[model samples]
Target: MTPARFAGVLSAAVTLGVAAACSDGGSPVDPGGCAADLTTGIAAYDLDGLDVHAVLPTSTSSCIVANADSHFVAVDPSAQPSGRLFVFLPGSAARARNYRKIAFAAARAGYPAIVLTYVNDLPVGVRCAFGTGDCYEEVRREIITGVDASSRLTVGPDDAIEGRLVHLLTAMESLDPGSGWSTFHDGASPRWDRISVAGHSQGGGHSLFLSRETTVFRATAYSSAGDLEPLSATPVPWLDGSWATPAERIGGFISEDDEVVSPSGAIAAWTRIGLDDFGGPVSVDDTAAPWAGARMLTTRAPPRNAGAVFTPHHGVTVVDGLTPLELDGAPTFGPVWAALSFPGS
Candidate 1:
């Protein structure tokens, strides 16, 4: 876009407030080796035929209050569009760049993908540990919609997760109009029905809640669904709250030996959400693609970093650092990701 035209869009964004702070023109990056993509517990994904970019959101815009980092965008140069956008969110305090492998896999599966940067400094469970079940749901509502429904965090409409997504998608439309990002946008809001949502850990919880709030194309959680209620065998009972996505339209993946959230609690949450209607949680290690048509999927696969002292069970499913590697350097859990979010590919 011309500089003057870009300025006009920025002006419009500022006027809109909540939708402000979309990205500047995205900058191409070497996917195989971005320094920040790899850290103490994060991994960098190598590119196959995908173009990876780091697009900085405008700090002047309202949508970037709690955090002002770049969002990661991935696209396969040679794949046919799948008529779907794969949206990935990172865990608490995790950087967006750390999720390139998951996003790259999505791109290869024919869906353009993005790893968003948002206000994830405060984990939901940590902030709402002592409250009732509604506290968990309402905190998430505040985070995603800026509804001020909870007191855990002060997220405004502009700094809410939805606002950040709207901003980034708007950025893609303005800076890369020919890239087809507009297909996921309807008017000023995201066409959530055409978007598939998934994430790791805390992001996974957010994914579940967002799916609950809207009829997303699909909802998949990796290594998380919801936090367990303290001193209880279940997650905070909020699935029965106002809902949109059905249990059948949702899928989840996790390491069977996760150390963060109790496996039984996760299973309890899934069962209560009605995932048992599709089928019980199936192990990906013994089963293949369809996984017996199950919506709740689990794996006993050991982490690659198991020998490095102790494995971080929570990172085994999708994080680059702990997830095992295949012979070709692709993520060991690559196929599982596609399975969890299939039909979008």
Candidate 2:
């Protein structure tokens, strides 16, 4: 169920309820249903007073955080928060800073957002040289062993990623008590029930995994990668004839021209999860068009730095110049911001 389809279904449900009420001779139902308008322009939320902070992890137990190799970018609202927390994870070899645009958009909408960078055990040069298959396995092993051996927290035996994430969330909760971290962590009578998580490439895969691992996150948006093995292994239903997450809670974006992660794989994953076809790909030249209603925005390779080895298509989701319609032409947010901000609206 794509977000568009989910919206349609929700609208239908509301209509049916209204009809039932009318038939019962009750008061007329209010015409206004859900507050979100999928086709409407992105909201022009104010970003003034939003503070951006860089935090270096001091916990030696978290190998990914305390190793001096990993850090995070946090965007917090100046006033009391709305209790909405958005977590962004970067792709392999990419740092948190790359996704600052998305975080800035989330902050503008009154949600405190964090862009988290994991240990880049495999640098870009090494990854490009060895290829994704070998480097992926090596990075996976490093995360597993690193967290199991060094982490003080324990989500589960096979949940090293979740464990490290827990540590980070704990640290962030302490950093800003008013930022709603306590609501996320307090098991008993937690002030908040769930959060929003988004990522790109490898980070996207991690976001998907976290969705299944914890019910703490109410929504997830991811791009560039759709390795469904982890989701399949978990009890969460996705394309395997089991119940799946509500479409409104799961948002995805992928470039048809992406050379790194196959667009077909992403489509297959989306199909299995039951998303309606939003539309054909947006041309690279159509970067200025509004992307509020687009589920998949086809784009050409983004311009790369001189002598850069990797292709630009792979980095489309994190490009700094892109913006969602909600930002009203603010070029600071990427296309993925639509999905990240969708559930909040």
Candidate 3:
């Protein structure tokens, strides 16, 4: 997609007050790892054989406002002519940086990708401090009920989430110098072919939501159960009925022994996806190796819900139990990335 051709249609979209949706005047940080324009249409940047960049609604800013830095990452895979998109709400600067590496890998292997980084404000008092802690109901209630507080640190309304995402998309298509980083494929704004959404934990939930939106190609949900609290003996109502797409079309990656997210939940989610659910497990070995002093496991796909469960202690990879994939140097999950990298594979 050439910048000149994209500039034409993008010009009109920038007009109208829609371009001023950014809450803050701040610009998104490229971080040197990923490349792309943050405001208009998708800007394809070639890096290490990967086509990488950020895509968003034309008008944008850096803050977590209604339409601040909601961006997407686009990567072209070497193995294939097309690419994949990873969509999520940006949690922090660190995670965004790491995501660039993952995108590079996908692109190097002949797969282009996209990551959605939109702003979302968690309710105040909603402590996500402990890994063993569960706050499913509290969080769910918070979502449906807007937070009311004197200090002004409360949750927003129903459209609060999707509304903001749409604003970001609008800003991307708009033609505004201030809101300047939205991008799309084929140089046309908002091209939604072969894209996928992904996130970790809460972000994963957002990915699933976007999948149903039908604005992208497909969705990839990782390590996120809509209900975070540990389920009681009685079956709790899940959003199984409201899946954005058919269960089989959604890709889920979870650890079998994940304490944060129960394996039972993963299985249930898979069942919801039905027989057509894509990808398989890549088990990581938990047994200790003689020389390495740690057990090694392998994953056929990417592994989520492993950080807190397996590496709870931090800086060390454990191998006591095994999942489909193991995390060692340069983590690789053929199964998880399989669907995202190669949708029909």
Candidate 4:
């Protein structure tokens, strides 16, 4: 389904729910019900083979985190576990429930996936818009660890992105002792080496930022490059910093016609991180699966244009309603998701 149209499905899921078929009229099968946690507006999907659960951050900790209504955990028992978890972050102000399709796709591919709810109400660029040196890194540090590094915002440690992941896994381990979720975290810290990170828009930038903090299994970005300073249009200083994850292990997808963020600018940021050294991004539209074995990827798919109410092309690569869909209601970019977020190349 297109990302622009997913919202309509969500609103209807609140009311019609199981009674509703795919609102975009692409799927022939009737869904039994909405994906887990309808009150939080997870889209109606074929959840038959997946064990999906909505976890509130507060369900595991006393701190009330952002997007508390729809933190999701998905696993498909039918698939062989890859022994790694896929962690996803939503764009600024976007809800976690809206991203279950991708998470479910990761789960079906045999990775435990969580669409985390972290503090992302403000864009990282906005927070660092006019700051003194590399405020981009400082804001990301504050958000991830809840340290008072940037003067713009204060994220508490318990409410920090790292802390919330630890809490979620700790709670999940307690809920299902045999699931082996405990391997990703101990009581205190996340075993960053055991996790793969992916995100859309602001979440995409944060994913790369997280990769810098620790050695994640892999890093994938969708519809995102790092934040650009508005005036000069130059990338923030942190994009050129020392990264723990190598460029070869990093992969990403972006829209050629992204309206919200410049596609060339996005590629420039990726180049700054050395993604262009192995190979420049190949077009997912013209190229077949594996996309010539390139780590960086792009698509020529156009965004949904609804007269006066338009969805940005920036979201065409993932969600926000512009992502293309197959006739069976699966995202056309499913292969891209697997190639990027899967356990290894």
Whole-model lDDT, model 3: 0.40
| All candidates: TM-score | 0.83, 0.61, 0.53, 0.83
Model 3, residue 126: distance off in Å is 4.0
Candidate closest to the true structure, highest lDDT: 4
lDDT of 3 by residue, 170-283 (tens): 444443222223433332123444545556555555555455444556555555444433434121344444544555456555555454455456545445535233323334
Worst 10 residues of 1 by lDDT: 30-39
Q: Say what the RMSD of model 4 is.
A: 11.0
State the displacement of the C-alpha of residue 326, model 4, in Å, after optimal TM-score superposition: 1.1
lDDT of each: 0.72, 0.47, 0.40, 0.73
Ranking by TM-score: 1, 4, 2, 3
Each prediction's total of clashing residue pairs, residues at least 3 apart in sequence or on different chains, is 0, 5, 82, 5
Note the residue pairs that clash in candidate 4: 2-321, 3-320, 3-321, 3-322, 4-321
Lowest summed lDDT window (length 10), candidate 2: 20-29
lDDT of 1: 0.72
Q: Write down the lDDT that model 2 would get.
A: 0.47
